[model samples]
Target: MIAQRYSYLSWLPLLLVSSSHPQWPSSWRCIPQPARSSVPCYCSGRQTWAGSLCGTLRIPGKRKRNEIMLRYVVALSLLALSWAQDCQVANINVMQNFDKTRYAGTWYAVGKKDPEGLFLLDNIVAQINIEEDGKMTATAQGRVIILNNWEMCAHMFATFEETADPAKFKMKYWGAASYLQTGNDDHWVIDTDYDNYAVHYSCRLVDADGTCLDGYSFIFSRHPTGLRPEDQLVVLQKKTDLCLLGKYRRVAHTGFCESGTSLDPQ
Candidate 1:
């Protein structure tokens, strides 16, 4: 098996030589076979390695074939990296010894990863309050489009139920108005500094592979303007840890909700 793996990586020398080329031919293609397939060969008629196989790649000529093989090698490397990420929702880590007292305050949504059928569009702000009994509840305001494209500021409320993990909570949320969205969600505090920024994640659906099928995330900041320059890198690393680095969009605040008549929860 080791010898076969070494033979497979022998193409790396050619890949290194071609790395300096300005452009690769777009006509090259590499289609890998299913992992469960019993295929006997790989690229260039080589035996399959690591229990995986590559399907026949189409190229116009010998030069294009070599370039395409280089791309195939890069694709394999990326696949390996993705597998190492371990995106299983149950395996994801959260903050340790979370303090709800310090977390209670106004948080502006600087960035968000919307789930399917996103309700909130922008100008999102959430206020967390801890009751006298040490229970956590929150209210949020955001601009949303309702029936027949009627845009309005949505006021939502949520109550958190404690769990075995301090950073993880079961959130029961509802809208101030009956027409808005309401449901239960898993609220996990991925990371936070309790003063500058906070990262929150929720998975509404789980796939068979133990990965998040449908989910949303929020990058919260104490200031509505945005995260501090020093906090940006830390938040970026937390986003990467959640496997949602590039899936977020900036949540803008243009005073849309502030101007509305909706009562802000106190």
Candidate 2:
């Protein structure tokens, strides 16, 4: 039976090469081997060709090809998504034609996204005032741990300089005490209803890719308790737009800095 099979297969090359089998690949040649041999017959190239003709021929079929194509498609899709969500700092939008008068007064920090080397921890509150010359100045109080483990209520003040965009300002801030954090930061009002909620953003460091490397955000509310139910949805949407949605932690108002005698920044 083995001899007969081999004899029958030995004519495969002549059959394949015949004009009657014009569809057969010219590169493929069937050279019959011993039945006990692992490769009884083969086609040329890296891929074992003519898989349908040779039952033992190991070749990548339609399913495997589809899998390879699918993998490429998935990788490209992920790369595109990453590009879409790059969160470029220059592309971030701030409030249009922001009214300074409407934005003044006390704002309670309801949610906060902290930056690297965060100073404020919780119980944050900000008081904004417009000076007689229409300059904006703010005073903020928050709980902070400095000198490694010494916790204290921080009294901070900031003076904002006008920029080309009304909603954007360059903030020069310093703590009342010498031990507190002090620096110049970019202040942008992302969104503000003035009467209810306001979103503030600051980027301390921008990466080479035009994305914010070190930044912070504050979700402020007119009320001390936090944003109202209806306003929560609006704030949530703003948080998502800022790309700092899940990065925020609730800012508690435990009155840690409220009762403390805050020193006036000279």
Candidate 3:
């Protein structure tokens, strides 16, 4: 069987909605309807390509109620030079080589980059799986050794994103950290091995006016439990093309992960 390892979440726009993959059952989660924005965005839950925010994802219609909101945002972004700055995008491969049918299951995270405030994600792991109707599921878990500050509620939820063309379909994340639906960012799946074990994530920056910024990239993989740590690291290193900002580290073992900053990393 070909390993459909290519799965990672990307940023979602406020108008769109989607999800990350967790080893989930074949049932799709019904998202809450979006609050309704004048200009909709594409969003997901996976740090990169989880899913867009909402009960269902299809570019939301511009609400008559939010028409003013849309005009204001477009005008504002058009004037900012920063908004014009190049955006961070991914060179991720949309693992189209394999049948999407094979990638329907779960995965765990074993490593990640250690940024100044991201300690909450250290030792944190994520699960990935696909639903039969075309939705994706992501179950994120983190073990914070100490309760200190590096702990937050863990989460398990299901939502929908994109899987249109296996080779061309990429992932994106959006909305509240806990709600997988709402405001969003734009992350794209830039690279993936046809075998589906490894994937690269990147996204355009989210500017002050809600526009995408320069593109940045990261390598996400099945936990070391699935791939050899050394081998996974090798694959990561080979992706030097990614030019990541920092090095990978174990997520802080915050035993409290599940719901939100208000909850824990269960």
Candidate 4:
């Protein structure tokens, strides 16, 4: 299979922290997907948006960063499971129509928060590839909260629809079943059109077999970048997806940019 690489995030001091439009369940808390992040965002932990940053708290960092992160965000990692899990988790398939190829690319970290605790992959990047093997390979670079600052690189594998319709496919990247409960049942993708340049990822509260419950969803687009601001006010409305705008953010800048002045930026 052919492969390509892209550019790194230019260090930019933020003007302000960006928040998301998420409908959080009372029982679930939001957490940053990445291990290190500046601002806290709301997410279910099990399912990540299309192009947003995502990482669980794997290693404890400085006492300060740990305390600060836990105050505002949920803990889904091994370090912080004792405080939550008071309710039952729902199960469902949420990706029946979402497209796959359109979802490939680099996405930046916007926001995240979960019960497992707060995690943000600061200076983060997600590189997803649909290889000949049909399995998705994810390469990510970000910082883990440590005594100083731990910049980490992680490689993860996700399995996609083997029996799913190619037209509308689904993908499962991670998270344990318990963490996924009370969220989307099974992370489904009900609709997607590769040539159409648009589609979404969906999840449910139940599984096909009914053995487990915990679902999530993440929508994607054929185009890399998100809908333009002017388009949102007029012709282009902010389309909805499982991951919301997170999936589309930085999509144009992922694993391999569609076209550019330089594919490898040093």
lDDT of each: 0.79, 0.77, 0.40, 0.34
Q: Each prediction's TM-score against the native?
A: 0.71, 0.67, 0.43, 0.32
Summarize candidate 3's per-residue lDDT along 15-86 as a digit string, tens digits.
232212323222323334443322333233222222333334332233521453466578778557344443
> Which sections of candidate 1 miss by over 4 Å?
1-15, 18-80, 261-266
Global local distance difference test of model 1: 0.79
Worst 10 residues of 1 by lDDT: 50-59
* lDDT for predicted candidate 2 compared with the true structure: 0.77
Model 2, clash count?
A: 0
Indicate the residue-level lDDT of 109 in model 1. 96
Per-residue lDDT tens digits for candidate 1, residues 64-154, read 5466677887999977876799888999999998999999999999999999874788999999999999999998899888767777888
For 1-266, candidate 2 gives per-residue lDDT tens digits of: 12233343443433333324444444444444443554434544322333224442222333443454577679899678656774889988899989999999999998999988748888888999999999999999888877687777888999999999999999999998886788999999999989999999999998998878899999999998989899988888777777787899999998887676444465
lDDT of 4 by residue, 113-132 (tens): 12223222333355667888
Instruction: List the candidates ranked by TM-score, beginning with the highest.
Output: 1, 2, 3, 4
Q: Given candidate 1, what's the lDDT at residue 259?
A: 75
Name the better of 1 and 4 by lDDT. Answer: 1
> Evaluated with TM-score, which candidate comes out highest?
1
- 1 or 3, greater by lDDT: 1
Better of 1 and 2 by TM-score: 1
Worst 10 residues of 4 by lDDT: 9-18
For the record, the alpha-carbon RMSD of candidate 3 to the native fold, in angstroms, is 26.4
